[model samples]
Target: MLPAVPDRAVDELGRTEGGPETLGLLVRDQHTRRLLLLRAVLDAAESAGPGVCPAAALARLREDWALLEEAERLEPSAHRRGRPYRDGPVSGRPDGSVPVSEGPRGSVPVSEGPRGSVPVSEGGAVPGNRPPPSPVRALLLHPLTGPWARDTLRALRSGTGPLTGRDTREPARALAHFGSLAAVAAARAGVSYAVRLTAHDGVLTLPSLGALRTGGPGSGETEVAVVHRRGRLTLRRPGEADVVVRLQSGAGAWSEAAAWTSAYTLPGLVLDSAAVPLDDLDPYRTARGGPRPDTLSGPAVLDEADRKHWLHTWSGTAAALGLGGERRLAEAVTLLRCLVPLAAPPGSVPGGAGGSCSGTRREAFGAVLSSAPATATVFAATLVHEIQHTKLAALSEMMTLHHAGPEARHFAPWRPDPRPYDNLLQGAYSHLALADFFQRSALAATLPTLRDAAWAEHARYQAQVGAVLPALVGSGDLTVRGRKFVDRMVEVYERLAEQPPPRGHAARATAYVQAARALWTRRHAPGE
Candidate 1:
């Protein structure tokens, strides 16, 4: 069952962004929500009862589910933190299942929810807001969202009133592919597990772990025996043995080498025993950095050197993030399972001045789509900012914060054009996190020059969020509770603003706020 959220927790998220319990609860809740989707998918297929589902695939699906159950059976801590597990749906129902709908990407909002902001993904053209993944784990494989899992769940339930299962074909087949999670779960629970893992586009992409590039063609189905035991995760196939790169230490190579059958597998990143893949090889994630600042929709392959560059950049980013705050860094690491690199545009100046974004779906909850920054500090800032969006996106699933539609009608300092109310909330929330980061940095900086730079950033985002609060509170778009949430945010701004900004920044921060609105007014209003 999904954990119940306290009303006060909602207010606390608004007031303080989030601390341990709040953040932990959000992460824990996501893990539960993903499980809920997995269960619902199982139910939908079983109720179809072998008559509709392909018999062989159906049996495998049951085994797949069984293996996951076995992982829990052997180790119940599968539900606890630091255990394992995303990239699926959220539960709003008593049974912890999402009522299937026929809208855009799985869940069709019958009441019409707002579309998410577009970014580095999908040709830099705007894609719809990525709400919670519609609980279908299949969406995790392919980058595209469509409709069809025919005779599966979408077709089984008609006019179910609001959710959409047709976003992809063969969702049941997709569910079977989900069997790949069995080994991942077992390793996480520190128990032994073995299961036939399905290859997606010639790869077994394990969410928290890494992918096994089985060297199969894109046109067919291939299965590999994925086994986890004694702190090791291994993939076995026919005629080929792929090498594994330990993403993080803790894992040992399998002692049993005789198990064979995975076909033509190529060496890739292998994660076991609590290792999380900071991956770039996964197809669903951006392979190369694109123009979009946050999300990368397009996919490309990075050469070995490029891959090395990413590892180096991340190593630096992780170290720099450590300086932010001990507890905050720990929470960030927990919430941040992986980082996908965002390629810097040519001629880009040194340091952060680039884009990065956190995941919006259940399957990708702890991941971020980011660019490689030259400076560690700016890179850390991008993470701090993006993680806030991650937090808020998860929170939005827990509570209805605003009713902003698709239309852009509000001012956001971060955006040039007007933004939708929901988008505005995301920006304010993230900027608050940034403001806090800068505040801490400014205080910690020893040099006068460094302190000034940090405080300027602190002043800019702090003022920006505060100036925009009225639009959020008065916009008539936020729900009553959402207003209360924003109200707490206003209080936070006031408390932070009371300390005067460094020299030249009070006016500069005010101008930064005024300048953004002025530019927005000029473009949006033009005549005014």
Candidate 2:
């Protein structure tokens, strides 16, 4: 059973007056927040008439504070805040057990009702003069741990929907549109959801109720139904025999059942604590970056032990880097879904391999780590590098940075092979982040040896960035927006370079980058 929600509680909007108690539930649990938001939309649709008045919704939320609070004191810490992604075992069933009948659960059957099916108009304002309703007919689910959440909430409160290029409408059509929009947003955001919608008898059903699945058969399933009861809105689900769990009023009774299935065993990767072996690789795994094998030849799972150790390392790194806020840390982790282990090829470094698929498969932004890292520091650094790739990939979708043309391959200091303009941009952005990470480490280092090592790393990354920035600026491949992006990157590097490192370390780092460039030119240049 879940803990009861506080009566006087804050929501994602920081509104403390009477709102839906479920918002309090969403504030507490980051994993299930999206599911609850979906539930709210379905409920609102069932209750609303032809038109959904934003004013009426807001008024209802304000008057219903008591049911949600229930005498429990709402604490600030109960709200979802940014924290390091912990690898500790996610305690719960992979697919939560719902008390439903023993049978193969299929899609809900559509049935006729007394009111009859109301044919929803495709898109337009209501016939009569009613104040423009909220654009967000479907509730927007914000990330519990990132800056995006705050931005989304602000937009929602201001009567704007996060989804673009969609016609907002009454409840039935709005629910359908939201399902499609959410899937697109999740793919772009590097997140995944098990969302399925079925409409029957003027009601909608969310099968799976926001739980992530491993696609294994015979797993238990839960379905949430939004229906009208005696002209009042109610959310219903099956319970013990002859008993149905019906939730009405503003109280958040269904909050406890929402659980986050963070870890599971995929075809080629084991996320969280699952001990399943990888027999075949998922086709979604990208072929770029690292070696792509047909099947698993060696260890391909991120086990429980490694997860705990790496999370500890990440926590320490975040503290050292002054990234204590939930938003900052969540920015890194929210885009990172899972880590898969890979076997290194012959004659290659065993434990020093990391590959990101953000460029090719933006939807599957999980990193494939080659062999477990020898230390937490290595693992943390690899995570930082890979997630940066995901961030840049998402940004590229929003704004076109480079011109569309035949790929212009160029010499990259880190990769042995020549890289295309897009890949080059990805590397530059990631290395810039690495430089920031090292700078933070250097500043926070307690011992002289550690400080010196950190400073050397910081200088090395700066030199690499300095080398790449010029090529990016001169490539002539960047669009106007692309040029602006590269210019901002250059500005950051210039600021960091102003903070000079130890004289000897700076010289060596600069010389190393120059030599690497020279070697690349000799090999890859025309008529060398």
Model 2, residue 105: what's the lDDT? 15
| lDDT by residue (tens digit), candidate 1, 1-528 | 456667778877786455545766786666545434444555666565443455666566555544444444444343333444321121122432223433211321121111111111212122333332121222222111111122234533432334453433354455554564445544545555556667756766664445566665674566776655555566767777844322232212222233211211111111111133444554445421224433333333455666665556655665455554443454454465555554544555535343333333334666666555555577677778777777788888887888879888788887787787888888898888778778877877788987898899899988889877888888777788888888888887877777767769878998888988888888898456
lDDT of 2 at 147: 21
Error of 1 at 118 (Å): 34
Top-scoring candidate (lDDT): 1
* Candidate 1 local lDDT, residue 339: 55
Q: Encode model 2's per-residue lDDT on 365-428: one tens digit a residue.
A: 2333344455545555555566566556545544467874556567788765677888788888
Who wins the TM-score comparison?
Answer: 1
Give the poorly placed runs of model 1, Cα more than 4 Å off.
1-8, 47-53, 76-169, 186-196, 206-210, 216-220, 223-276, 283-327, 345-352, 355-363, 526-528
Cα RMSD for candidates in order: 11.1, 18.4
Number of residue pairs clashing in candidate 2, backbone atoms closer than 3 angstroms, sequence gap of 3 or more or interchain: 5
Give, for candidate 2, the lowest lDDT window spanning 10 residues: 110-119
Model 2: CA > 4 A from native: 1-299, 302-317, 320-330, 344-360, 365-371
